[model samples]
Target: MTLALFDLDNTLLAGDSDHSWGEFLIHKGIVDAKAYGKANDAFFEDYKNGTLDIVAYQEFALTALIPLDSAQRKQLHNEFMAQVITPMMQPKAVKLIEKHRQQGDTLVIITATNSFVTGPIATALGIDTLLATEPEIIDSMFTGKIVGIPCFQEGKIVKLNEWLSTTGHSLDGAWFYSDSANDLPLLERVANPVAVDPDERLLKHATEQQWPVISLRD
Candidate 1:
């Protein structure tokens, strides 16, 4: 079966759902009070603009939420399942996911967002698999650190390659759908790349590459 990799956040949810989830945690006092809100806005900003440095995310996540021990960060990320997501998912995106499922494509939600916040979202969508950033954890608690690589840009490729090796699936005529230039690496790697309401940079690049662009938003 072919694969269809979908990005979370703006690709499906219409906004930075993970950051919004972080915002919810700030309001809930789930994360460190001092590191809440825009404490790492620079990282989020770079992410949105498709220029994020994964190393910065790792550093910032650790230094920003020092108050919360690993347990606390895990708790916040776990609670984020109910408090931060669900409501943000768009009906259209859900429908698209269902459509892909009905076609028998192996669907995976490949994102740079943390696995904790995105795990439930991927489950809600009935995704076959998920590949995202892994937050640092010790004794089942968040360390406020990134012990592994942040899944973004070229990182998706690396993660996908490893996953394919496990699933015995390769990117042979597979598809990738996303709306951000940050996802350009993913789009380029896939055999059939479709940009849905892509940002300006992605739009231009897709045009140059002759990759098909689909617009769900007017």
Candidate 2:
């Protein structure tokens, strides 16, 4: 079966989950509103500009989980789902996923966001496989550290290769959908690269390369 890969943030969801999670923390008074929000916005900008320091961003994002136990974190995330993420779920995006599902594609959500923030979002979308940056855990608690390579840019290719090796899956006829220029590396690797409501840089690249550009928002 052909592999169907999706980028989780702007391509699938209407908003960025990692940034929203940071906002959620600020809203719940778990983090300093000014400092955390500023950093969050700055990091998002860095991501957009393709200048993001993945390890640094991961450290900042995952650090919030270090203080909470798994149960508490789950509860907060459930609330986040209800309050923030639910509205971001787009009907067109769901339809696209369902269309692929009906075709028997191996659906996967590959994202730079940590698994703790994205795991439930993937489940809510009815996707079974998710490849996201992992937060190190010990004794059922987050250690606020990454276990392996941060799944960003070229790291995505590395992670995908590692997964492919064990799962017997190949990129033959693989399709990748994404919105950011940062994903150009993997987008270039896929057999079918679709830009969903692409950013300026990605739009320019997609146009020049004649890649199919579609939108989930409209």
Candidate 3:
């Protein structure tokens, strides 16, 4: 069986999943409204410029996720699915997913976005498998700590290995798609690495290596 990995933020849709999650936190009174707004804006800016590293972003997101009660977090997750996910899924991305599904590939959404937040999006997209950064929880509240490695940069590969071990799969002949320099480790480990609307560093690497490059999203 083949594995097709997708980066959840820009490559799949127009915005960052972390931003959406942060918004949900405030909308649900899980975080300070003004603080959520500021954090999301800063994160979006750095993410777009390729300056925000995944590990740091995960840490920030965990802190943001901490204030919500478990029930509130659960509700936010559901609301995000209904609002953020249902509308933001792109036609082109769906098409790509369909094409891979036709081949019976096991699809996975691997991202630095929190698994609690991104899990519903994956389910909404009909992706049953997810490899994402998970937050530690205590007494039904976010502990401001990550449970596993941050699912970015080399962490993507580590998360993938954990997923494979649990699911009995490997990276031998799988395909991975991403749009950032931080996703390089995942792109390199897979048999097929497609850079979709990659940033400068990834674009340069794709050019030097003659890797297939496409503006999957604009």
Candidate 4:
């Protein structure tokens, strides 16, 4: 069986969901305007430049939910799904997903973004398997901490291997689609690496590596 792994943010959507989710929260006044806003922007810039500290970024991203009740968080996330994330979903992305499904591959979205932000988006795309950073929760309250390794850069390979072990899946002949240089480690490991509107570094690397390059946007 072929494994088809996809990146959630810019690869499948028209925008970066992790950064946009923070902006959406700030716009809705859910997260504070000054502290969270500034940190969010800075983190996004770091991510774009492939210099992001995944652990630190996760702390910043997940902590905003610490003070919120379960019901409130759910409601706000529903709004985020509707207002912020849905419009970013592109037609070409959906079609690509469909094409992969037709190929009978076991589809999984592997993103460095936390599960809270990506779960609903994955459901919307009809993808059942998601490998994302898991936020720690206790008694329905977010602990503002991440469990296990943050699936960024080389960590993605680690996480994917662990998941595959549990499911009896092998990486042989696997495919990965991503748009970021941060995913290079996992991209290189996969048998088929497709760059989807990749960043400059990833674009150059893909060209040098002779990997297929495709665009879901445009």
Candidate 5:
């Protein structure tokens, strides 16, 4: 089967889910506005400039889930799915996914965002397969630590290869769509790489590589 991998944040959705989730929590008073908000903005800026430290940012993002119980976190995620993520699903993205669905490819969303936040968003987008950063848990309580690879930068290629090995698939003719230069490793690995509203770094890379660049926004 052909592989079709997508980057979730700014590639499919109109906004960055990881950053937006932090904003949502701050707005709901789940996180302190002044400190959390400031740090979140700084991390996002770092990400845009391709200078983000994934390990540090992951700590900042996932730790927000530590205090809440599973039920409370689930409820908040449900609210996030409806209020924050749903509207960000661009119609163009849906149609593009549908096109690949009709082609019967093995569709997967390989995102750097932690599973706690991105899982529902993947489901909402009609994708059942997701390879995301896993949050550690102990006795059903989130530990606010990453369990395995962060799925950032080159880590995405490693995670995807592991997933492909278990699923009996190959990236021989796979397609990967992403927005940031951070994904350049996997983007280069795939046979068909599409840059979706890419950042400056990725746009320049795509131009040099002559990869197809498309926009999934109005």
Candidate 6:
């Protein structure tokens, strides 16, 4: 079966879940509004410029969940989904995913955001498979540390290759849709690379490479 890989934030969704989660925490008074918002914006800027240090960013992002137990985390995420993520979902993106499903392609959401955040979002999108950065957990509590290679930049290719090996899936006829230049590494490896409402850098690269550029936003 052909593989259809999707970037969760910005490509499939209208906003960045990681950044929105941080904002959500601030709105809920869970984190210091000024400091967390400043840091979150900085991290997002780094991400856009393709200069993000995934390990450091993960440390910062996952640290917020350390104090919450599994149940509390789930509740908090549900609120986030209802208030933040729901608005980010786009009809065009859903149609794109449904199109792939109609073609019998194996669908997967590959994102740098932790599984704790992206898992439900993927399920809500009707996708069964997701590959995301893993937040370490012990005894049902977050450790605030990542357990494996982060699914970012070249790390995305490494993580996807590992998943492909275990699932007996190959990149043959693979289609990857993404919005950021950060995804160029995995984008280059796919059989079909589509840039979805891409940033400035990715737009230029996709133009030069003759990759299809499409937008999910209305």
TM-scores of all models? 0.85, 0.99, 0.86, 0.97, 0.98, 0.99
The collision pairs in model 2 are: none
Candidate 3 per-residue C-alpha lDDT over 33-88 given as tens digits, one digit per residue, 9 for 90 to 100: 88768977787778767677666667777886676787866776777777777677
Angstrom error of the Cα, residue 5, model 4: value is 0.3
Count of backbone clashes, every candidate in sequence: 5, 0, 0, 0, 0, 0
Reference-based lDDT, residue 7, model 2: 99
Q: Which stretches of candidate 5 lie over 4 Å from their true place?
A: none
Error of 1 at 204 (Å): 1.5
Off by over 4 Å in 2: none
CA deviation > 4 Å runs, candidate 1: 30-35, 62-84, 216-218
lDDT of each: 0.76, 0.95, 0.80, 0.93, 0.93, 0.95
Error of 5 at 149 (Å): 1.1
Q: What's the distance in Å from true for residue 126, model 6?
A: 0.6
Total residue pair clashes for candidate 1: 5
TM-score of 4: 0.97
> In angstroms, how far off is 76's CA in candidate 4?
0.4
Candidate 1: worst 10 consecutive residues by lDDT?
Answer: 58-67
What tens digits encode model 6's per-residue C-alpha lDDT throughout 88-169? 9999999999999999999999999999999999999999999999999998988889998999999999999999999999
Q: For model 1, how does the per-residue alpha-carbon lDDT over 144-179 read when each residue is reduced to its tens digit?
A: 677566788888898899899998998998999988
Candidate 5, residues 1-218, lDDT tens digits: the string is 89999999999999999999999999899889999999999999998887889888988998888888989999999999889998898999999999999999989999999898998888888999999998898988887788888898899999998998898999989999999999999998999999999999999999999999999998
Q: Over the stretch 137-181, how does candidate 4's per-residue lDDT look in tens digits?
A: 999999999999998989899899999989999989999999999
lDDT of 2: 0.95
> For candidate 6, what's the RMSD?
0.6
Query: What's the true lDDT of residue 201 in model 1?
Result: 90
Predicted structure 3: lDDT: 0.80
